[model samples]
Target chain A: MADPFLLAATALVALALGLGLARFLRGPRALDRVVAFDGLTIVSVAAIALAGLVTGRAIYLDVALVYALLSFLGVIVAARYLEGGEQ
Target chain B: MSGVLDILGGLLMVGGAAFLALGGLGLWRMPDTYTRIQAGTKATTLGTLLTLAGIGMIEPGWALKLALIVLFLMFTNPLSSQVMARAAHRAGVPLTPQSRGDALADDEGRAAE
Candidate 1:
């Protein structure tokens, strides 16, 4: 890419994604996996946003917005499922 | 002026990405679920916000949409974290062995008093 800063940013976000994935795989508890998943999705959203910036395309940001909303909903629903009737 | 903006935006994006990496490190290294949640939620939220802001500076015309994403994230990120934490607490996900008391559990005890 022409932008070294953004290129580095992409690498860092990719590193984050890898770490989150490792945690998701190594989790001893369901909650840990959920937390890892939450972090992973957020990183993915950031990645999408970075892609938008790098490509100079506003449309990617729209995709990012929808992704963020859906991930939030997914996390909430998963948490609620795990909470069961204890709430 | 545009050059300066580009430089500043690049710096912000780099900083934000660094924060995102730190959050992932925390997720990998933290001993327990709650601490991991704290690390994952707070750091990534800030990182995402800073990143989006940098993108906005680089492309001013996209500011409104970027702001919408930022606002939505600010509202939902912590809320989802809170929900997850509460769920984990109720589901009996134990804390780290060396950790202090849980205020949420204490609140429950006090409520019964």
Candidate 2:
């Protein structure tokens, strides 16, 4: 239960999540929130992958893959909506 | 051989996490949306890739799927960031005062004509 790698990775990711959340909450613009959200999602993908590694299961990687795809699509949609939602 | 792989995987994962943290910090501290996008996207992309690579190294068997995820991220992260930046620009988001020029603004004007 005391895996150094897992512990280190988790701590670093937690730091990232905290910072990203701070940006998201402190956003001065709508698009700023969007950008922070994107970063936060990517960081989560890494965290999921680390979880997969820790558990010794490959399934979590698949979940990470799907999450990444959804994140990309979501960001694209959000950006388009911000661009006056044309077309 | 096993020991070497374990060490390498741990190193890669740790390094990746460090990059992720840096990306987050940049997102927090960057003055403008454009700069935040640059910092957030580029660093996170590398960080995610490295973390995935480390996972693949440690497990070996999951290499193929991890590679697929890596390839997908390579294409999407930057594309999404570019989309966001373009949208922000079109939405009339202004650059910081210190920013010298807006090349896209010139092109946008031409396009509007």
Candidate 3:
């Protein structure tokens, strides 16, 4: 059976994701949006990991890892571009 | 014993999720860009790490991989946020009125000579 706590945790993470999206949409500046985007990605990682735990699947952990790496790279690249580091 | 472990894992997951929610709220409520980044990065990093560790506790065999994920996040999250903050500063995002000073700005001024 899936753990009840894991289910609750997933719901919490989803709520956090919604809040991040709200900030992203309400941004007063580009960087504010980027910060919100970063928060969204981190919460998504937590959500995915919690899902893997609830489902009893090891493979989903791999997916979470890859997603984390890709998100980190994307944030860094976007930051660099914002800093005028070239296209 | 298994039940005990399950309870522990559940507690950790709940705590982690609470922190994640706190980070999101900070992002919504903070006064300025740098403050929001600070709130988001610090809280989410701890939240994600706790969540991964909780998952590892639930599945002993997956502990190693989960630990690796946590380590990667510990390293990357702060670095990425720092980069973002610097970029925001350079892009001329203004600080809130309560901000004390810009040490980086002073450094840049000294370097320009």
Best by DockQ: 1
Please report how far candidate 1 places residue A31 from its true position, in Å.
1.5
TM-scores, one per candidate: 0.92, 0.93, 0.92
Candidate 3 residues A31-65, lDDT tens each?
78889989998898888887777677889889999
lDDT of 3 at B107: 73
Q: Arrange candidates by TM-score, highest first: which order?
A: 2, 1, 3
Candidate 1 residue pairs in clash (backbone atoms < 3 Å)? none
- Which lDDT tens digits does candidate 3 get at residues B1-113? 58777778788888899899999999998999999999986798899888877777778798899899889888998899999998987877777889898888787774211
Worst 10 residues of 2 chain B by lDDT: B104-113
- Which number leads on lDDT? 2
- Residue A39 in candidate 3 has what lDDT? 93
Q: Which stretches of candidate 2 lie over 4 Å from their true place?
A: A85-87, B109-113
| lDDT score, candidate 3, position B54 | 78
Clashing pairs in 3: none
- Chain A TM-score, each candidate: 0.88, 0.90, 0.85
